[model samples]
Target: MNNIKSVFSINDLENLSGIKAHTIRMWEKRYTIFSPNRNTNNVRFYTTNDLKKILTIAFLNNFGYKISKIAKLSETEIISLAQKIYSDKTDSNFAISKFKLSMFNFDAKLFHETYDKLLETKDFEIIFYEVFIPLLDEIGFLWQTETLTPIHEHFISSLIRQKLFAEIEQAQKNANFSSNEVYVLFLPMGEIHEIGIILVNYLLLKKNKQVVYLGENVPMENLTTVVHHFNKVNFVSYFTVQPEEENLNTYLDTFHQNILVNSPHKLLVLGKQVHNFTSFIPSIQCFTSIKQMLNTI
Candidate 1:
């Protein structure tokens, strides 16, 4: 038998649910909704169940459910109501709510079921371009608004990474390496966000292109070495945060001077920072979207 006594401190709740500590305390005092336990020292602590309850409540509140009505529901009833709300076909709002619920509950089964249902009716491209991308955009907004925390982001991102990896593996089996142009995928130094880069790699491999993925935080000097070896190379990277806004011009100038200007190959850059180089970007080739980049190659 497993112990059900694992306690989560108020900090844990804040970290897991993105709800402010003061706000959670106010809710506790103002309403009889959340009742956390006290340790031997009389310090309050929450449970996994409490985290789930708060997540459900937050989701409902975001969707315009009155806090008064939400506080009246029992735990079981709350879960059931969340499921009903998630299943309604109104819009992407419901899907986003369901995805958040899955993250809060750590319910991989629910995540997979919801994703598979969407996949069944829509093609993978539609699912990626329409559903997954929009969901991620919403997640970004929630994070910025402090409506979701790092824990919530990591929980859902890991699941999405798993799905991407599975698709990549399947694509690799059929990928053709006979071509001379090998695409090298990487993220610049100090940049660790690889989800977008990984998805691009998956798409390239799916299209039967040879891809060499150096992953995150790759040094520019090391990339120069790769350029030397591959006779026909197209280097790709996602520049989310490596180069600060002020230094973006310098970074692009150095890249153009050192790599793209002289080399016979091309360098494809994406992400928000790339917008800084719009004027100076060489007509050789630059892409803003994955679909456009893929089409070019």
Candidate 2:
């Protein structure tokens, strides 16, 4: 809990709040809004309280309130105005701020409320691209910078996975695939990142394609067994932290020999590792991002 409430540098605030450090400094000096503490080296930092205050102010500012006007309002008044703003309507930026605030405090209510509010106006696809994607990208940066904890990461990710699963189930009920093409989605063995694959499943369902979701860390042989049974199999995998960087090429070779050789199956791969490979064997397509894969799908 203490880790979750830890302090953040000015740069972190800038990253998390989408406010420039220079602007934050100017507001601090002119409006006396946030009283951040300074370290022994005179480097300034802010507490969780300061972060929440800035998020609230940023939220209000998005609703057409001027910085000067926001600085003049008391914290209580700021909260009041923010609540009103939130109740009426919100955009992507406001939704991101609310999501960040919820993640920081582990406040499920705020997270659900923000998501529910977005659902009132937008569909699942709109929310995923506009809200969840940006929020996840920010969360990744926060994790990289040590501003957020594993607990925080898991909390938000689990909630999102739940929503994705619900949406996927709902979409799958009415799938209308004309072709017998089956998409077999999974992460490579030793790779555990399934969010990319999960999103792929959702998109494939939206395309009304048959999806055989094998999910995370599936073995190459298991994939082969599954593909052997299907006449038109499109094996998709997200290569996040697997296929050992030193042996990525070797892993691809093994995958090709075992899965694609003498078979009509096409392998579609994505993630950080996929970028490192300069070339791929025949029938193997490497995608840099989900959007690129979406085009092919």
Predicted model with the maximum TM-score: 2
Pairs that clash in candidate 1:
none
Please write out the lDDT profile of model 2 over residues 80-150, one tens digit for every residue.
88877776776787788877888777889988888998888899888998888888888888889777788
How does residue 266 of candidate 1 score in lDDT? 73
User: Could you report the Cα RMSD, in angstroms, for every candidate shown?
Assistant: 5.7, 2.5
C-alpha lDDT score of every prediction, in listed order = 0.75, 0.84
Task: Tell me each candidate's TM-score.
Answer: 0.70, 0.89
What C-alpha lDDT, on a 0 to 100 scale, does residue 100 get in candidate 2? 81
Could you tell me how far off, in angstroms, the CA of residue 223 lies in candidate 1 after the best superposition? Answer: 0.6
Model 2 earns a TM-score of 0.89
C-alpha lDDT of residue 122 in model 1: 67
